[model samples]
Target: MQVTTATEAALLTSREIITGEELGSVPLATPGAVAAAARRAAAAAPAWAARPAAERAAILSRAAELLLERDQEAMDLLVREGGSITGKAFYEVHAGAAELRHAAALATGPDSPHGPGSEPGRETEVSRVPLGVVGVIVPWNFPLLLGMRSVAPALALGNTVLLKPDPHTPLSGGRLFAEVLADAGLPEGVLEVVHGDADAGAALVQAPDVAMVSFTGSTEVGREIGATAGRLLKRVVLELGGQNAFVVLPDADIEQAASAGSWGSFLHQGQICMAARRHLVHQDVVEAYTETLARRAAALRIGDPYRTDAQIGPVIEHGALTRIAAAVEEAVAQGARLVTGGRMQGPFFPPTVLADVTPKMAVFHKEVFGPVAAITAFADDDEAIALANTSDYGLTAAVYTSDADRGRALAPRLRCGVVHVGDQTVNHDPALPFGGIGASGNASGFGGRAALDAFTRWHTLTTSSPARAYPF
Candidate 1:
């Protein structure tokens, strides 16, 4: 377990910098290379799960047309190894090439909208069956689009994967997904990449030939990988972490809720888990939305995430800028009110904006992430739904308000799972379903048909028309 390979450095300002590339302590896979890649994906998962789901949706629509013809080398390795910023690295390579063309249009067709005829002469079918190998454990914030939205719908539903990434961005998740699955031909052990970190993701989630693991990142290591994949009964897909809450509503539009809550709390600089780390506001336009969100978070443009007028970058390493400057110096030593930009400077922490934040501050109960923000000041509408349902995090929440009945009556009392009104819960759309709820972790990451029903697993063949022979 002594593999060592490091680099680190970051900066991006005081004499510009950027280094990253680390691997370090790597020894995990030699249980005969995880049993020969899980016995060659259990002997090619029953012939790629009996092929023809429109030929596995035409190889995930030619790997989303070779990932939009290699979108500027996948936004320059997601802005040089995921520190991302050139407009959030071209919105994570155009939302991972539109989540691989919406999982190749849900794998070319439809089989179960819970209908395939049953109970007449009986021939019930509710298809979707891959779940053979898939171990994916990505996360260094949008590292190659959430590891190609969890390895392109688990290789367009025929499953078989090992992925792992995030040892602080394993060279853009092992060289941009082995050069786009070798330019879309993809067959060599379906999809493999096993770099290491976090004990090689706990040896591929305690590898018992990995049946299913998905995972994204931190909800305290996704509750320890859902308690070690629920004691190895496997099948998990968590996409944890989010302190998300934006609110606003004193008939919001105070310059579009202060430019969408200062670009959803400093875009990637907040090291997003759906940024906008709690704002609340609305004591009748809390002093004009905190003076137009502290003049749009001090007119952003921090530095060097490959420019393009860098809307604040650089908080990837340096221990997330020293835990976001120690959660804004323990929320200004527990009195909160730094009102605008708390200074960090090296890993650029300026976009900060804490105003009287109190949920017994720890940047308002943890998950500050980076570009530190924390407002809080509600009056009406049930005290802005009791300060956005005081968090234990329910992921995405936002509600600027021009009164669409008070943003649909305070968006379901804001307990969160993905709410947005006038907009800025970091609006996403990898065909929808994103996740979060309580402690911000409970499996979900864009619903391209709910990620093929979380990488498949269901079987029920009941043919009863064989002249009803009853025998218990």
Candidate 2:
């Protein structure tokens, strides 16, 4: 793993999220070390850029193969260290591999060298060029998938990358992915890993050699990083927090709505950034929907992450577990009804649904990244739209209705970047531009081509055709 010795002053400590056991420590990277890595990446970037797109895509394709071969071990590590269940772990493995292959396909396509032709004796040539070194900062949740979204694309598009994974999840989530790419014939310094806290992340954001910063984390952290990236006029891709709202329409299938909402709220213990923390249902069907959702949520099995049949797993750590517990307790104290699954055992928080959640409560107004979903009944379409748009975040919103046209009509009123019809709010596809607005970050507006478009700048070339006077 090329792990450096841990100094007493800067030790990188990690605890097993499932078992609460201690993991072997590694040395945290200092600002100088981060800058050094960035410098090395900047030096190798031009040579990489010179390589043909097909050749660069070959490496990314090979990386996908290598990741599939090591899938089981990777899933095990996610379960042990990252508190991911078996199904979620398997999803992560295949999803990460698929993203790499998708990026590889984008790399193999034509580079758009021909641009557009002008009739006035001139032609404009447009091309996509790398923006030097790309600094990727990923969070503990879905580290492999999020990291690959930026890394695979940058590598395929011929830009060097310096990845700094969350310090709380160094080995399984961050450093292991780096090692896998290394074994797949990636050149040294082309993809390097640094482990540390916020200091290391700030170093990457502020480094002169790093042309752009691609970050995925909380809204608070995104704001701080966005401020710096803005002040310096450096490029950045921020996928921040989401207090997403899932609307249940009157004509929606109650069972399907309940099932999708339960899964969206309880998956990964609801630590996901796009997880549906708010449930807005039409008053006409509120009683039936709440009952069905509570029943479905109660049926989920929560326990050891390593269990084959376990559907719900523990939260990432003790602090997160405690925070979730307190949030639930406070909601109950504020006159909210605990529908089901309010028990806490160690780090495990079973699927919980709260009814009668008013806007004044913390759970209703704030972003609770836990397995707690609040169900509120809206009198009409106008009231429901108002409720969903009231949140400060505009990351993702969903509307569930039997009629596709009804879903489409209602989804537009919710203020968010991505809106799904007859689907859960907790969804992601690499081809779709995944981001947010307001307190949640906004999209760079280049869809499908996520990190590649975000990390590269466009240039237009013109050539005058003055000698064409012989044309009759």
Candidate 3:
């Protein structure tokens, strides 16, 4: 097995790598190599699409079993390659395996809502068919889960896939997945893993034979891919960036709200797009809630990602750490006060809590992809709603209120795609639709059954008796 390194490129974290080996230099894939992989996928797509749904499902199920069997190895790779805590990696593997199982179940069941069904008199049938080839561009955060989320469904739907995992964590997850699928008896060229950077991603998206492109990354990159796919007239599913808000109401339990805020903001070192970035608290409970949150934030255990007791880990790389530090510094300079945990040690930035953060501060308005939480006090219900909806993002939001009426009422008013009451927004069930609106890229909805739909194209088959034939 030959491992080749492309030109050295700089990452947001200032970390560099060559052939999956980090050496304080950024790594990238050459345009020719990515294009070749795309071509290979395109060439093999039709044959893959011809495979029966049952066969596809069986193979995917085998892959799932393999993943479960190698759970520890997967978790370790996730932690080392993606910079996530051991617990988080465990959850990733579990969720990813579950996704594969669900997708397999869906494949063997029916042809979706559009599939053929029995009727008493009428001969009507609809079918769910593969859309040839799919290109999945995954992110560094939750690398294993997100990559599998897109790939498993696409493969289950009988579509060949060219998956380009995030360059930062490509070899660990991507190589493992490819090996598993191959060992599970999946047809060669049906599932391919390409390692590279943005040029590689662009090649996958622009490949003329690709039927759809599914991407999970920042909003800026999503826009670029969406525009390219639009020009090519190919379907696209994008899960982009988010600046989710966590609203703490006057009647909320201060302790519960504080705990949710701490976990929601610092989980995965706050690299999650759905992680609560803004903390909008009611004036009545603001002081107490802030105090509790600050105390909890400071107490978080940050160490190597492989440590079981480590609650927080490094921010992917040093460049990510730098960007997060700069965001906090700018926010403080603009008037926000850092309550605790703003300093950086290696790639780890201690869980940070910022108080008195007005909407004007960058930390309040932008997606600070780090373990930083910005707190602002709102005087009343209307003010809280306004503050929460002020951001350009509407991916996810949370409202903490004990009153049933208040919680229900506020839920509908939130501009986000998903909302949780009395809890910080972190719920991601494989059965429910998950995607966002506004600046969060336009995929409409995805996840669970919706994600399965994204991997297919519908075809209607209507028949009529000879006597009822239409006149030409």
Clashing pairs in 2: 436-441
Angstrom error at residue 140, model 3: 0.6
lDDT of 3: 0.81
- Candidate 1 has its poorest 10 consecutive residues by lDDT at 8-17
Model 2 per-residue lDDT tens digits across residues 121-237? 687778888888999998887888888888888888889999998876787667777778888878888987888888899998998899888888998999999999999988888
Query: After best superposition, candidate 2 residue 263: deviation in angstroms?
Result: 0.5
On lDDT, the stronger of 2 and 3 is 2
Candidate 1's clash total is: 1
| Cα-based lDDT for every prediction | 0.75, 0.84, 0.81
With a 3 Å backbone cut-off (N, CA, C), the pairs that clash in candidate 1 are 4-24
Any runs in candidate 2 off by more than 4 Å, and if so which? 1-13, 21-25, 112-123, 444-447, 464-472
Q: Candidate 1: deviation at residue 194, Å? A: 1.1
Q: Which regions in candidate 1 have their CA more than 4 angstroms from the true location?
A: 1-24, 27-128, 135-137, 141-161, 169-193, 196-245, 251-269, 277-314, 318-339, 342-344, 347-351, 354-395, 400-407, 410-417, 420-452, 457-472
- Best candidate according to lDDT: 2
Candidate 3 C-alpha lDDT tens digits along 1-472: 1234444542322122212334222234466666677778878888877877788889889988998899988887777677778788889998988888888887887556643456544577777788888888889888888888888888888788988877777655577789788888888788877777687889889877678998989999998999999999999988888889999988888888899998899999999989999999988888899899999998888887565478887777778889999999999999998899888887689999999999877888889899999999999889988999998888889998888678889888889788888788877776778888878767443566787678887777767565364578
TM-score of 2: 0.93
lDDT against true structure, model 1:
0.75
